[model samples]
Target chain A: MAKENKTNINRRQFLKSTAIAAASMAAIGAGVTYIQKYKRDENNAQELLRPPGAIDEDAFLYACIKCGLCVQICPVHAIKFAGINEDLAYGTPYINAREQACDFSCDSIQCAETCPTAALYFIQFKEAGLKAIEAVQQQGPEALKNINPFEVQVVAMKKVTHIGVAKLNEKTCLAVKGKGFSGTPRGENFNGVLRPQSIKNQDGSKIRKAYPLKEQKYEREICDLCVTECPIGEEAITLKKTTNPDGSVSYKPNVLEGCTGCGVCEMICPTEPASIVIEAGKTYEEVYS
Target chain B: MSLFSKKREPLPPKKNDEMPHSKLGMPYKEWMGMNEDRHKWRNRRWAFLVFINLLFVISFALDLSLLEGSLSGSRLLGFYLLDPYNSFQLLAISIKTEYLPYLTMNFVIGFFTIVIFYSIMGGRSFCSWVCPYHFLAEWAEKLHDYLVKKKKIKEHSFQRGLRYVFWAGFILLAFFTQRLVFETLNPVGILSRAMIYGPGLILLWVLVIIAFEIVYSKRFWCRYVCPIGATWSIIGNISPVAVKFELDKCGHCRKCQDVCLVPHELWFVTRGKATNEKHYVGSDCTRCGYCVDVCPGDALNFTVKGLDKIL
Candidate 1:
């Protein structure tokens, strides 16, 4: 009878311990997942400006390993990893255009090339680059004399790269305010670098050299940095003279379908807090419409 | 008794009490003074941790082709290296056929390289030797021990098996959410990335986990919640490198068990308890060498499955 009692106590103790462990595990697991679900909802709502060649935002979030390879390979130093507060997007690379923009001066989308996972799907740009080269090849040797195949390939690659669309805030725009401000767009303290349109690379291969904004000076009758400094040029954005309600001519920057939302316009804007900003992950149709 | 009140035990003489005071009459000792004998394995582990993690920082700063990228994924001299746990989470999230193409051959090679390397080194060696978070947690554990010894707090513990449940939970979380859900809050990845890319707000999460270890339980995250450790523990099952025990050499002092990170693995080392003359530590053992370090009789030792005979 005593032996039976001892066995019963041992079994009871084992059951009790197991029950506690099971209960605790269940509680902790459910708690963590619950918090994660809440954070994930908040995370998905964030529309971040991703690196060039990034896929659709939802799919990109799923596919990105948060490796930061894109951040390392970006020659312009445009990409930065998202903070923990970004939740699901934490450690994922994003371009803060105001800080630095993808100038595409590398003539190669190195970030996309280095991406092990096709989170930044390079094949789209790769196909576009191939098509540009193929078109030049088809045009015979005469086309090659006038046209730089490498430059055309890079431009075509840039066209396919839609990270976001630039939206203009007309109220804060210096051009709309009818102001002709001079000196550097950003002050002498600004550290942002860009491959200026006037400066050509010594190599003449169309891979432009980047210079700090502090070192470059700009004199304009009206602020047209967004238009003049655009890497994609006239196809992406244009400054147009529009007649206002007072019958006064006001210059406005017009965004077109060719806008890659590479965010050069947003980065170069002289106005504090930026007069123009990229609506991250928005397509040309979505922004214009 | 009140709900929060506890029975206070009388304090014993601390190690600091016996040590001579400084010239200024302040209590002084070696920084993080552990009175125990010089731990060779622990020193080697700290060195490896510092060197490996430093390469990640140096490579990025100098733009060296060696060991680029953080722990999540890296290129060692243009060769890919991926954290197996993080890679597995990616696999779970992108399990669909269409997504398979996105996961390139480089990822496969990186994953296998990490697996093979860890397996050869005895799997959980990564936890003790290479994981920066593990090193931090060890410091937190020392603080925890000090608190416990000083009678300031009691040691709170949980079933170590909870980690296996967490391991499965993370994979399922990835599958259901279609995201690397844990990476957002993973301390291991956060610490590793912080070293390479400077600290971010995510480091707050790591701080909270460490605080939990110190105040609530000793090594809470590592012992009960780390999916990375759990994943390696599974790989450790097949690992040939193990902590071998000789029954005759054991003094029955049980000091090894006292120092073991996972004490359950060394349960058979008790006096007259082990069935075999020689027994190998269980898969759950981190093979951290704490047991070997603390063993006065030199009973416990690191031994490769077949290498001991040749040596």
Candidate 2:
């Protein structure tokens, strides 16, 4: 009996140790296989919106060090780390447009500026978006004078389509519903803003003044906050007048070619979930793939 | 065969009381100044980790944008964001979402270069020596040691294997979900966000971790759970450097295992007896040198295996 007890103790230790070792090996193998198979799938990431000036979704995934630096330095605190449920974008910085938009409150994109690697690609903004880059290569910051400074800086440094275009959900939009709004979109307590554009007056003289979107009162027979409150202004979103079934005219928010997707419209939209949503990391391609 | 070799006689001195001053206990004249060098590599590791974490925290806290173009405000001075998991996440997500080629020079550098660095370092020296969360965990360990005073303590052995499961599950889930799911639970990201943005649900997660570490865990998070440590440990298994044992010099004091985060690995390596070649070289061994420092026998030292010949 004593001899059998000794043998049993040794056997138990052996079994326990082997089981742990085997589990570890199995886990490692499965992990490697999972990563390998995922790599082969082309449509694994159907949608992801990286911060502006990010190179590519795949490159951004590995390039970002997950330091949370970008999330830290945003002047408006627009940037946030992706939550655990967000798959591979976890720990990486991204913007949730409806909650808060990248107002460029830092004058330029601060998140991209502070990224250590080319993950955020400071080079993307060094030239600005492609057009701004082309403009600089052709004329210089002087040629970019007539355009919005923020637009010039961003476009000169990166792709215009770096983020997605904002599409308005017509059925719910205040303007599309033919409902006129008279007060602040979010209420007096809110702190949202409308970036005053370099607008041309009657004599074509430009007037630019930025004010809190919540402080500004709107009184249109058809609400145009989606257009008026858009930080990118007409360059990104526009109000298109259309005839309703009652023969009454209403306006639909149209995303234009110049939409750089700063996502201000999505933030200031009066709708609960926001009538406009930025389909992050998309182009005119329009499909998820 | 067992993690605890045997009960140690007397008690080890706490770190605070090790130093004495005139107003405090020993006179200044008798002190002959302070012998600050308690553990060479161990203290150095502590200092380096503190420096790294401080730099990371400060960089995350500062706003260089206001000082743009100024030397003090230079945007270049940000944290390395050098967590290995970032590259791992990229590798997993890139494969699942797109083809492998979507990876770039940056991804290649972060992924391959860092892995090579870990492989050469033997095991995860970074976890004990550089990871931001480690400094806090060490303090928690010290606190637990103080709190667990005379009571018999037992480790939840099952949780030891959970880290392996976590490491594997994280990668597999990343592939299946094509999300950087591990990033959400990343202590660095969570803590950094908490510090920079003010405490919220992220900090709540931190509180949960603190409760686990201080109350129930023996540094279980790092020893078994972290995927980053798991990755480094695997890569570091064949690491050229390790904490070697001098069996001839050993007094069988078992102080080394008492201070070690992963004592089982040390026990495994030093099963029959401690020696240079077969000494503790576990992958998850963070090379923190707690074992080396506390070893009353002076049997352990960080060494480059084969290079022991030159010495």
Candidate 3:
């Protein structure tokens, strides 16, 4: 009886050990299978011919560090970051110039210049070739074909609208307070103010004197923050020429397209409180219009 | 004469007393017997794991076409399998000058897959089972072992710290130059590009590493210099899955430590002790489970941490 019990115990132990070994082996086998599947898929995918214009497919695959500089600096904002698409090649980086084509004419090669990873090469304006122009023309027709030109859709137009113009209140105007058109010596507290009709240039290059006239000439140039501070390349507020009654030409301010509705111009206006304001309006029309 | 009668004539009942304890340390037989059952379990796990890895390699090769410019059905399958949108552009930038937008989806997916897998199993699954780089490195190390007589290299704490510094420098360089210098040097990239563009100096450099692996050590490059490995390691921390060691059950045999390709410093970290003055192990681990297979104690097991647990 004792011998039989001992034999039975040994057999049970052996079977249990074998079972454990088999189980572990199976688990490891499954894991290895998964890895093999993943590698095979990855390898097979790598062999396909890259899309047209792909330079070094392998380097680009590893080198691209996703930074949004190209998208930010694109003049037409044509570049957009790609999202996950399983059917497509590994979603790394690609240009979609169908919407807003690459405007190579922009002064700064900001996209390439600002890219944190030389994922984008910086090409000089001349070197960028005819592709830049072709891209723009292609985009123009494509964009127009998609929708109504005057429609107020977000995708169709730049999203800034002019609100209002800067106004100088005479009572608070620096020139009315005897503080000169340029305001304080430090130029910090420059309320919109006109200079006295006759004043000496700060430098002694021209000799002149101030005269207290009965009526002040409102100098349009006194407050140029709106014209100078706009983020758009061409300032939103631009100086336009107008003929006066005396047959002399004078300059007046005009707002141009491409304003981003970022109120830097209004914020920087040199009034006690800002004189320039972006009031809500339709199509950025004039206050009287 | 009858069999029973003969035995009776010689019979003095045999003494059945237990043997007295000898003070010359525990007997080897008893010590080994006590651990034999546990060791069997471990050895079995190890063998099974290796077999699985072999299967995976076979499957991958069967499915993928490594040849260049071959428009096989597998190539189409590869395209559908690995989305190449951004990867194509990145490769272009690496070879020539071109501007393309950077997209994060692929990186995020690759990162998340490793993290998710690590959380489900222990770290070794990735190294032993999934990572192609680990396989390459291991093959290299095996060659090294064969040629150099299986000598071990001692990894100091400072060497681990240097990896972090190297990764930081890579990031800074990319920030300044807007180029992935590290990726340019990556062996995988070199191989793939060479296959596509034909062999060049870059391919020659990668070939040297392969030679080194065959003769010197397995995974020498991955342990020492892979930036992608470093990236995965940092991300792997949040992985809820890890190998849990039962210290009480461990026999102090150090078998698990021996098979581990990652530095031993990591095991020290997993045990809740700081190794090399760092709180966490450096990111060289691919979580391959070789260590679990070699353990004699059956001390290691995979476990999940709660959501509140810090990765």
Q: Which candidate gets the maximum lDDT versus the true structure? A: 1
> Which predicted model would earn the best TM-score?
1
* Lowest lDDT 10-residue stretch of candidate 3 chain B: B67-76
Off by over 4 Å in 3: A1-289, B1-125, B146-158, B191-203, B213-219, B266-284, B306-311
Ten-residue stretch with the least lDDT total in model 3 chain A: A45-54
- Evaluate every candidate with DockQ and list the scores: 0.28, 0.13, 0.03
Give the runs in model 1 whose Cα sits over 4 Å from its true position. A1-47, A85-88, A140-152, A201-207, A241-250, B1-36, B95-98, B247-250
Give one digit per residue, the lDDT tens place, for model 2 in B107-183.
45445656777788867787777665777888887876766674545444444555666776776666665545566
Candidate 1 residue lDDT tens string, B112-183:
988887777664787887789999999999999999999999997766767876787777777766667677
lDDT digits (tens) for residues A112-169 of candidate 3: 4443334343333223333444445567777656644323221122222222223334
Candidate closer to the true structure by lDDT (higher is better), 1 or 2: 1
Candidates in descending lDDT order: 1, 2, 3
- Model 3 TM-score on a 0 to 1 scale: 0.37
* Residue-by-residue lDDT tens digits, candidate 3, B13-62: 22222111122245534532443334443355456545543443333334
Model 2, CA-based lDDT? 0.61
Docking outcome class, model 2: incorrect
